[model samples]
Target: MQSLLEQLFAGITTKSAEETERIARAFAMLVPVDTTLAFHGDLGAGKTTFIRGLARAWDIVEPVTSPTFNLYTLYEGSRQLVHLDAYRLDSGADLDSLMIDDFIRSPWCMAIEWPERIADSLPEETWHLYLGINDQQTHTIRLRL
Candidate 1:
């Protein structure tokens, strides 16, 4: 698992943004629900794309769009994916107002972009997905999942 994680980080330094998203979502499909995944990356790092892929992979037929302006989008699949965008969150305290904690403890998978904005509120067992810019059009995808 350590080796796989290392490879994932290395991928961020070499892979295209779309490729990174594809891999991240595909990997996410393997993760069980009732888990929180925090995505750490700057703007345009393909975080939204990754979430979209995850929704599709999970069999969500409806369109998947980033919850940036909306905050969170709930979609149904074999399991539901609660996608949250923490970019506008000032602190973890904001999470409680949104009732995010309840979702985390349930049988739904959540993918949050800009997690650093609400890192403190995140559960201890949450997985971390960090994206690093390696080029103008490429990004590294690192997963601690």
Candidate 2:
């Protein structure tokens, strides 16, 4: 069995945003409820696209957009999905002001983009996904858990 401290890294190549979304959908099917996912990548790296797949898997029909200005957005369905964008946040206090702890502790599945900004506030077991652009404008995804 894998130890809690052991990290997992899985790499996959996606030639298009749609492929990236499909990959996210597969991962979505396997994630446990209440899981926290931290996304790391530059802008236009398909972070929101991955979350779009996640939202679709949860049967949420509403459009999913980065809550860069709002900080976070919550979608309700059979399960609650909490999407947080830390792009504009500069400190843990900023995340705290949003009552981030309450959301993390709740049953909602939390997906955070720009997580490095609030790294100290994230749970130890949080899953991390990195998206990078390759030479052909394809996305290379690295998922660590």
Candidate 3:
């Protein structure tokens, strides 16, 4: 699918941390159960927070954090959800090091963070979620298809 970045809603969350998770869970309703989401945002911009909400909404019981430590994390929720942090990837070669191509082709839906780090490896049909932060306290998530 084409990369789409459109403002669906605009609001301010004074308590960004807690509020962001609620927004993330709500996002779960926007796409198909088997759909993949590639999250694009800056550091501490609420990417993980949103994923936490996603997991919560999907009935993921375990904790969800930035998989930068593990490269990727999988949750066996009502639906399988794959979370990938591509920050360390510099090229397709690096992405291949993780052997994620097969996983991408699997039945699970994958959510990737820092997609800019692996720009070349993304499929033409991947969905992108662009996030913007202002004043280091406010964040905005835009859903792009």
Best by lDDT: 2
Clashing pairs in 2: none
On a 0 to 100 scale, what is the lDDT of residue 39 in model 1? 82
Give the count of colliding residue pairs in each prediction. 3, 0, 2
Looking at model 2, how many pairs of residues clash?
0
Better of 2 and 3 by lDDT: 2
- Among these predictions, the greatest TM-score belongs to 2
Question: Candidate 3 clashing pairs?
Answer: 1-125, 4-144
Ranking by TM-score: 2, 1, 3
Candidate 2 lDDT over 30-93, as tens digits, reads: 7888888999999888899999988988888899999867978999865689999988876654
Error of 1 at 27 (Å): 0.5
TM-score of each: 0.80, 0.85, 0.79
lDDT of candidates 1 onward, in order = 0.73, 0.81, 0.72
Off by more than 4 A, model 1:
1-6, 9-14, 101-106
Model 2 worst lDDT run, 10 consecutive residues:
1-10
Q: For model 1, how many clashes?
A: 3
lDDT of 1: 0.73
Tens digits of per-residue lDDT, candidate 1, 31-143, equal 77778888888877777777777777788878777775688888877767889887777654456678866654356887888888877778888988877676787677777
